[model samples]
Target: MYAAVEETVQARLILSPHRSVRLRTVLSYLPEDPFAVSMAFPAEFSLDEAEDERSAEDIVWVFARQLLSSGLELPAGLGDVHVRPTVGRRTMVELRAPEGTALLRFDTTDLRRFLWRSRLLVPEGEEHLHLDADRALAQLLG
Candidate 1:
């Protein structure tokens, strides 16, 4: 049987007046996978030319990168970060974190994936509360 593991990370979300958002996150790894990781702002959060609406795929990417970056050790087994933008019903990005590699899947047909993962699937939401980008980045560095 496949065992499911839940991990947590803390991050700050910066939203500009233009609606551009940046996420600074730190991922903490578990004993099973030992390496802490950090990401300043992954490309998924880049909304350069996007109109007013924020794409679910972008949001998912930010969350995924944030969570993965928190782990104990970035998995060496995973070659490199794999990002798949708007494809079929879901968008996915795969990358190694400190603990282990993570595959973030965002369902375009249902926003439930975002809400559920944020609330239930991941560790306690308290560990990943919202914060400022600069502060979050500082924590990652220190």
Candidate 2:
């Protein structure tokens, strides 16, 4: 078992052709706007990437995949929040509550591909992977 400690959420979204992900902590909260990069974090976290010969993007993706695979915690308390995906990989997590206020933001590029490939940890295993990392992130975060 692992003791829970204060941690930050550090995530990186790779560009096209090789969309990948990375983060130091398990994501907890997501802002309403999917495109805006103002997501909330625990204010304490870290990031990791190996010395593989792959490009920086590839490294980030690999790290992200490892983290995502190690994690399966989903989101909760999202009843009226809205999720919006822009033209680019940018996504927004929105919430319009009538009682309280809490906000945080994070952005992801090509989230579906990232989630499918990363969670599966199969870089070149399949072309039509069937997983929704993007939706999971948005719903969980939002």
- Scored by lDDT, the top model is 1
| Residue 106 displacement (Å), model 1 | 3.0
Reference-based TM-score of each model: 0.22, 0.27
Report residue 112 deviation for candidate 2 (angstroms): 3.8
The parts of candidate 1 lying over 4 Å away from their true place are 1-82, 111-142
Among the numbered candidates, top TM-score falls to 2
TM-score of 2: 0.27
TM-score of 1: 0.22
Worst 10 residues of 1 by lDDT: 28-37
Estimate every model's Cα lDDT from 0 to 1.
0.37, 0.33
Clashes of each: 19, 20
Regions of candidate 2 where Cα sits further than 4 Å from its true position:
1-25, 28-40, 43-80, 95-104, 117-142
